[model samples]
Target: MRLSGKRASQLALNAFIVLLLAMSIYPMTILLFGFTKDSLTWQYNQWLPALPMWFTNLNYAWKQVGTAFWNTLFVAAAATLGGVFLSSLGGFVFSRMKFYAKEIIFYFIIALMMVPAILGLIPWYLLIKELGLLNSLWALVFTSVFGAPIFGIFLLRGFFSSIPEELFEAAKIDGCGNFKLYYKIAVPVSLSSLATLAIMQVMGVWNDLVGPSIVLTSPDKFVITLALRNFSMSMSGGGMLTNYPALFAAYVISSIPLVLLFFFASKYYIEGLTSSGMKL
Candidate 1:
């Protein structure tokens, strides 16, 4: 059978994509296999998972990583909820309401996004200290809730503005107030966008190391990233690799929250990304 040039090109592109996907997941596959091996087997084999599947490593890793995991989950949840609410409210106001100098105000808010976060690090730390948020998870929550909303607002304003004006007018005619319109119409209509923002915020707070490292001085308050780093370093014991299976298990365990998040929210995440900003 002879293939047409277009068909041949399509097959080649599909094969290339599959190859790239495999390459991307290969390290993760190895990590999964590595976690199932015992220390002695890991030292000898160093590749495939061995027999007797040491589930003890997972138990040990869980004991070490569980507290930090819950702490991180709490932070991510609070930050995402607060940030998304504020961002959506701001977007609705800017898109639907009449206010003085709204454009200028929005542009000013958006302009802050241009200022690099690193430049504000010292000032932020000082403010957190002054507020007595040092050594507290609330510091991270406050920063994330306030600092991360600019981009969310920007993304959501377009979605809100694209909504048809007739819906608002009809709602208003039925005695719907601004807040009611926002809650009933705007929010329901933009679930995918809201989910997208929530996922981004959750992922950001979940993976953040620097903010938690600086604000949280106590081990009890540590997030997963910092905890994982400390765990790995402690396992190394001055750079001599000591418990590969346990460390790999910790890595795998730390990733479960994110995996579950994407698994559940993937439909909305994909829809939000692909959906156009403008509506007729």
Candidate 2:
């Protein structure tokens, strides 16, 4: 069938979008090629070449990569879990409860969010040092945990507020206590928001380098970001080829979990954002 002019224009627009997506992904695809290419010169060459791909050297990358991957995973998982629990609980309380100083306390918390992270970094480091948490994963985890969940709480509180008060009143009539109302009613109702928050927390903590760089000095405790920095340094020092392909391969590996999680939870994530009056 012959296309109308408008339909043809739409088809052209769609083709442009497809081309843009491919362009964005091309560098990453090329990096995968670089990872397997044995010769440094070949890997550095701008044009693609005809060569048989090899997986044998993956073991070499895997050796250090595996340990770093696990360390990062552990930190991200622990931080996300802890952050979700605390932020969700705080959100629930702020949404539901009324206390004499609650508003003041929350205002203070929100104020802290406005403070630049650099301004607090020195104090935070000093506190961590006093607690003897340096050179430990807990140092990073604890620091992240204390970082005010103003945004998380604010997002979740809006979501919780949007929930009908009638549901909680009905639950109370059924002899449900505060804990039961929260666990049975609020939690189930706000799962979408919670899932969104969890995804954000995971992505933030997983990709974080600054906190770990400051707190974790031990090689064994290094997260993927720290490990990547070390790898880059080693390459710079002539210990290894500064293979862009290998660096990109490591980045791709690190990014996969967060990407997959976001894809699967995309609907809920979008819903949560929209419901919470957030743009993205």
Candidate 3:
């Protein structure tokens, strides 16, 4: 059948997109398949386990990676919660409250984002050590610190600004104080933006490796990425790949929290991010 040029172009674009998507996910797909196998069969070009091997691999991977998984989750959750709350408050102030030097303060805060993160890492590590936080999850938490997260204040400020001033005035007239308004009114209404920020912070903290690797010296305190690297290195040591399927299984297991988090929060996340862009 003869096809129009535009239709052909659309078909070509769709095929390219699907191809790219497959390429992007192919490695993870292999890792996920390894979760179903009790052995490192990907080396032999085998993708799926023959049958009933999932339980054994999962158990092995859990025994190896469980502590790291929980540690990562704790750090991610702590950083996200604290950063979101503080950034929301900062956003509220920058957006709704008329305060002196607000613009200057905000611009300075945003300026920190321009300084390459790599440049700050040395000082950050030194600071962590000075505080005697080396080899602790507290170091990891403190590194992610409770401040306006990169772009978080901007997101929330813009969102808060978009909320009608009349709402604030109405709350004031109803005998609501500023704190009450923030707690009862602003927070409830800003859940979408907050959720978006929370998801980003969680992903960033969960995947973080270099910072934790530098700050955390103990094997047990390692976050997921550090733990994965350690596990892989140990397995590959002495040219003998030992139980590497269990490592792949760990990758699969480690990814589950973020996957489930996004699965649930995706609706609000998409709305918050896209709405901000549209408004801008």
lDDT of 2 at 178: 81
List model 2 lDDT by residue over 99-170, tens digit each: 799888888777776678888788878888899988888887766665527677877777788889999999
lDDT of 1 by residue, 1-280 (tens): 3568889999999999999999999889878889989877887887765787878999999888898999999999899999999999989999899999999999988888889989988888899999999998899998889866688788889899999999889999999999999999999999999999999899899889887888888888899999999999888864435888899999999999889999999899988877744233
* CA lDDT scores, all candidates in order: 0.88, 0.76, 0.81
> How many residue pairs clash (N, CA or C atoms closer than 3 angstroms) in each of the candidate models, in the order given?
0, 0, 0
lDDT string, candidate 3, 1-280, tens digits: 3568889999999999999999998888777666676544445645644554555777877877789888988988888888898888888888878888988999987777677788889998999889988888988776675544657888888889989888899889999987788888899999999999888888889878889878888778888988888877877754544675677778888989978998899999899878879442
Worst 10 residues of 2 by lDDT: 41-50
What C-alpha lDDT, on a 0 to 100 scale, does residue 29 get in candidate 3?
A: 79
* Model 2 whole-model lDDT (C-alpha atoms): 0.76
**CA shift of 26, model 1, Å:** 1.1
Which residue window of length 10 is worst by lDDT in model 1? 271-280
Q: Which stretches of candidate 2 lie over 4 Å from their true place?
A: 1-3, 40-51, 237-245
